[model samples]
Target chain A: MIVAAMLTLAVGTYLIRLAGPLLRTRITFPPGAERLLDVSAVVLLTALVAVTALTEGGGPADAARPAGVLVAGVLAWRKAPFMAIVLAAAATTALLRLL
Target chain B: MLVCLAVGATAVSYGAISVASGLPFWFPVVMGTLVLAGSSEFLFVGIVGAGGSPVAAVLAGLLVNSRHLPYGLALPDVLGGGWRRWLGVHIMNDESVVFALTRKDPARSYWECGIGVLLCWPLGALLGAALGSAVSDPNDFGLDAMFPAVILALILPQLRDAKARRPALLGAVIALVCVPLLPVGLPLLASLGALAVVPFLDRTTVEQGQA
Candidate 1:
């Protein structure tokens, strides 16, 4: 089951990735659609962050996780190195969980 | 490079956690190469680990990856056509796209970043698989927090642009609100509804420009 699912997902995702370049010449997105595409990365990414940080098993995660993500956010906002941001978040969460 | 290190760190966690969840170590190592996209792979492992149906996991993972459609659109030039384009698209992920767009030579940067991540992600997974047994609980070390933290860091710079900020904020709100109500991947898909505000935001920008 795992292997089959992974294979299907890999193929499906590959097609989605290819759809843009393949269709780029044949079709043109309207300006609004293009604008939506432009912002989609940030929008989707923000949503991913929110969902991953706040939810677990279709519900709210513990306070420690969100608090840790908040720390990472502040560090990221300050342009800290990627490793530092990750480490800080992990450390903060682990410490909070320990308490 | 720094990008490779960041991806490797997260991939390590992914590998370890997937193994700890009862997936065979080789499974994540292989998936890391085949899927290549971190977020969706994580979602897939999380669902299947929790005993969700494989069909459901695949569907949810595909939904999580729908963002790649726009990512591919944004980088048509970087991924020039021909047989090479196949590899190009296969390696397209959040890290590659983000890094490629920021460089002066996007085509070269894209390939270099993409290939680097491709190498490190799977290798990191392999290494973490080896270490998975040492750490019985990824959450105890707060490894679970790393995925979202890294992703948040990636998008933070993009959010600095006022044009992008509004939609991101709205999308986040949409996802957060739907978290409890929706299935694992559906909330993220529903967040796409935030794009509805883009037209209105564009009009305001245009009007302000003329003023």
Candidate 2:
């Protein structure tokens, strides 16, 4: 099931990528639909960040986890390097848990 | 270029983090090779690793990747024609698209960065998987928080656009509210409701943002 799911996602994404080059001349997405697509990426990713950072086992995760993620967000907003953000976020959370 | 190294780094984290999340060791490597989109792969690992249904993971991945459709429309020339186009479209990604837009030769830049990320991502995943398998408890290293942090960092650029920010903030609130009420995956799905509010947003400013 996992393999099948991965394949389905891969193929579907490839098709979406292909649709533009192949169908650009023949088809056009309505402006409203285009806007929806644009917003969907941010909307879904924000939810992912929220859930993964804030909730676990259907409740809020330990405060340390969210605090670590909050620090990561500030660094990212400040344009820190990706590796630094990852390392610092992990370290912050680990150190907090130890305390 | 440096983009390849950044891509590889993220793949390493994805590999290690997904494994730490209890996915099979091989999953990240294969998905990195096949899907080759960082955000969607992360979404898949994040959702499926959390015990969400495979259907939900795939749905989330597709929606996140739908932006590629517009990217494709803009890059037909870079894709070339004939059999090469297949590989071209496969390599289309956020990094490649940015390089294609900014570089002197769109086709060359597209292929170089796209193929560069393509090679590094899966290889990095394999290496991270080896490291991840040795760890007994991911949370001990706080690896569990890495996924969300990486995702937050990736989307930070998008959120700078006020047009994107409003919907994203609303969607996040909706998802959080649904967290206690819905099952694991459904809240993310329910977050789609925030997009409905987009039509009512000021389209003129949004058009400028897109431009």
Candidate 3:
């Protein structure tokens, strides 16, 4: 049953990933469509990040991770190196966990 | 090619991790092989681990994976041509798609991107799944968190305009508010609702510019 479920999910997911390009020849997005597509990435990514950063211990964390995320965000805004921001956030989280 | 090697490494790593973690072994292996999208796969594991229903997991995974649609649509224009075109479209996952699109001249045939994704995605997943089963404490080493960080890394670099920035802020606010209000899956839905404003905003911008 588990294998079956895995296979079913795998096939279904693959089909969706393939669906866009499969129809690309048959479909052309209208003008400004590309711009909308571009914007969607930002929105989707922000949503993902916020969800990950804010939630902890089965709910929103009281503090720490959110603070770490904010610190990372500030570094990101300042155009810091990607590794630096991530390391800083992780280090901060580890420190907070220690306290 | 370098891209192909990267894709292979990614798949192998993914497979190893999944296997080491003692998940339904085939789940991550197949998901890494076929689903080939890391964010959705992470969501899949997360939902399952949280004891959510399969329906909820599937829905959440699909919602996250929907971004690939735009990627597919945008690719042919960049790749251009016959057989290579179809292959290019097939391989349009996060990394390859972005790399192909962002290149000044890209100059890669569709087959190159297709081959790269085909190689990297499955191999990475396989590696991770295989390794996952062997490792007792995956989280202790921070491997689980690496996926999200990778995703965020890919995403943050692309918010280069006001149009992009505004919707990101809106989506973050919506997600933050919804986090307390909705169940796990529903927050994602709410975020999508927030994203609906993006198209309207873009249209209004174009009209104002013309006026």
Candidate 4:
């Protein structure tokens, strides 16, 4: 099952990734949808962040992880460097787990 | 180099966790190369580890990865044609997509992806798999926390733009509401549904008579 799923996803994902290069010239978004496309990355990424941070294995995330993400989110908002952001978040969570 | 390492970190940790979770040793190495998708691979492992159906895993992965469509449109110049195009698209992921879009050059994308795919990602996974027993419970080292933290930090810069504020906030709200009700990735996908309201939102000009 795992191998089959991996192969299916690998193939399907390749096609999905290729769709951009292949369809670039063929289909264009209408004006209204085009505007949405502009901000779609932000909206979708933000939504993804919420899911990744706040949930785990299809359910609510545990306390330590969400708290860690909160710390990271604040540092990110303050424009901390990437390394610092990851380092601090892991530290915070690891420390929390110890406590 | 930095980007390559950054992309590899999550894969390494995920590989470690997957192996710790009893996935075969070659799982990450094979999946890392064949799939070359960071987030979906993580999601796939998470689902499969939980004994979910393989078809469901692939479906969830597709929905999560559909964002690549817009990414392709964002970088239409990705591949000219031929086998190179296949190889190029196969390496497409969040990092390469963002790199391509920001640089406005597919060559840079290919270069960075070469760094991530050809060098860092698979090797990281292999190393993690090799050390699987030593790194049991990735969460103890905060590997679990790090994944979302890293992703959120990378995308945080985009929110500095004032125009992104509303759609981002509303999308968060929509997705959060759906989290409890929907399946794993569907909430995030439904968040895109919030885009439909973009045309109607904050349209003071459209509501001229309201004043």
Candidate 5:
């Protein structure tokens, strides 16, 4: 059942994804809407990150996770390599876990 | 080539995170293969693991994925016409669309875009699953700490201009406040709530840009 669910979900997602190219010709956003759509990615992604970084254990973490996220934010602002931001945060978490 | 690299990199990263977090190897593999959207899949797994209902998981996944609807509406012209063109557009995601739209070569084809996304989807899932199975201690490499940060890093480059930036900041603030107040699935709802405000708050900006 799990496998079936997974497969169904996968196909549905693929279909959803495919909708863009398939309908590319049949539909069009107005010029103004197109501009708004362009920024949608940023809004969507930021909300995602915020939810992940801030919330934990069914509620917001008091400090440690946010601290880790802040470190990551700084690395991100510095435009450090992707690996570095990840490493810095993970290392901080592991260290905090130990202490 | 860059598209291929991005897909490949994402697959590897996901694989590492899943394995480190002790997720079933098959889960992330299936997620990558089926969901195709990275953030949504991650949210689904995290929610399910945290004991959220499957229905909630599905709704959250769909909400995060709602952005694709507009992308669908916008892409038809670029893909041209026909059944094949339709199939191509249906599979288009952020990476493929950006690649297709920005290709300097006028001759660049939607076929290439379709093929790239389709091919990468499974390969990434398989790779992540395989790697997850192989790594006994995924945390030794510090992947758990790195994964969300890496995901966030990938997300940042998309915030291009002031109009987008304002809503993004608003959404982030809402998410932060909601984090303390909501359950697993409700935060996603709150995020959507944040997004719902984008049109209302930025009507002037949207109007100005559209004009």
Candidate 6:
């Protein structure tokens, strides 16, 4: 089932990519749906971040992990570089776990 | 180029992360080869790693990647002709598009896409997955937390406006509420339901913040 699902997505994504060349001129996504698409990436990603930070195995994540995420969030909010952000989050959690 | 290194880094991390999450070896490699798009590929692995339904993962991936549809429209003429068209569509990616759009030349876009894809995917998949398997401990670096943090940092700047933030907040809340109820990937998929509200959302507000 997992393999099939992956393949299904792979095919669907390929087609979407292909849609450019084949239906380029005739294509026009509805304005509202397009807006929805614009926001959905942020939406889904935020949800992933939220869930990952707050919950684990249907419950809240361990304190250290969330704390680490919090620190990372602060840096992210401040626009830290990519490496700095990842390192800060991981280091916080690692240090916390050690205590 | 700086872009190649960045792409390679993300790809390797993606491969390592997927392996750490218990994905089969072939999963990351094949996903890199087949999906080629890094963001959606990571999302797919994350969803599946967390025991999310593959069906939901596929849909969510397709949803995020639908952005490519616009890329196609933006450069209908950029795509190659004949058999190359089939291969050309496969290599279309963020970097290539960004590069292509700079000059708006068809041949240049095609070549840039090819070069970007060729350099980024395989190196990341092979080396990253190998590194992932070699590491004795993924938790040592708190890598599990690191993945989401990395992704969040990337997307954080995009939500600066209320127009974008509101929908994202809606989706985040919906997904959180569903976390205990739905399977891994479904909550994320459910978050996309926030989009249904868009027909009523002032497109100007949303579109205004956009480039």
Instruction: List where candidate 2 sits over 4 angstroms from the true fold.
Output: A1-25, A30-33, A57-59, A80-83, B1-28, B35-85, B88-117, B129-133, B180-186, B203-211
Give each model's clash number: 0, 0, 39, 0, 20, 0
Measured against the true two-chain complex, the DockQ scores of the candidates, in the order shown, are: 0.71, 0.53, 0.38, 0.68, 0.40, 0.47
lDDT per residue, candidate 2, B1-211, as tens digits? Answer: 5557656666777788788888888889899989998878888888888899999999988876776765666553687878988999899986676566545787898899899989999988887888885644557767667768866876788788877889989999999999899755677767879888787786667687899
> Which residue ranges in model 4 land beyond 4 Å of their true spot?
B50-53, B74-83, B101-114, B205-211
lDDT of 4 by residue, B13-124 (tens): 8788778767998998898888887778888887788888889889988877787776666553656577777777777766665555444465766556555655678888
What would the per-residue lDDT of candidate 6 be over residues A1-99, giving only the tens digit for each residue? 877887888899899887755664465668755555556656766777888787886787888888888888899899877678877888998888888
lDDT tens digits by residue: candidate 3, B1-211? 5445434544555565555445755666556656666656666676666666667667777766666665555553554668765445556665565455444555464446566667667666766665664644433333333333433544566666666667777877787787777655455446655557777777888899999
What is the Å distance of residue B116 in model 1 from its true position?
2.4
TM-score of candidate 2 versus the correct structure, residues matched by position: 0.64
lDDT of 5 at A9: 56
What TM-score, computed on C-alpha atoms, does each candidate reach? 0.88, 0.64, 0.69, 0.85, 0.63, 0.62
Compose the digit string of candidate 5's lDDT tens values, residues B90-202.
55665554444434541254467557756775577568667765755444443444445654665555554565567778867776777667644345445534456556757
lDDT of 5 at B64: 61
User: Per-residue alpha-carbon lDDT of model 4 for A1-48, expressed as tens digits?
Assistant: 789889999888888888866776677768766667667767777787
Which of the numbered candidates is closest to the native, going by highest TM-score?
A: 1
For each candidate, the alpha-carbon lDDT, in order, equals 0.84, 0.80, 0.60, 0.75, 0.60, 0.72
Measured by TM-score, how close is model 1 to the native structure? Answer: 0.88
Model 4: how far residue B23 lies from native, Å: 3.5
Error of 2 at A67 (Å): 1.5
Of models 1 and 6, which has the larger DockQ?
1
For candidate 4, give the lDDT.
Answer: 0.75
Give the worst 10-residue stretch by lDDT in candidate 5 chain B: B98-107
Candidate 6 residue pairs that clash: none
Model 3 RMSD in Å is: 4.9
lDDT of 1 by residue, A9-94 (tens): 99999999988777766788897777777687678778888888988877789999999999999999989888899989889999
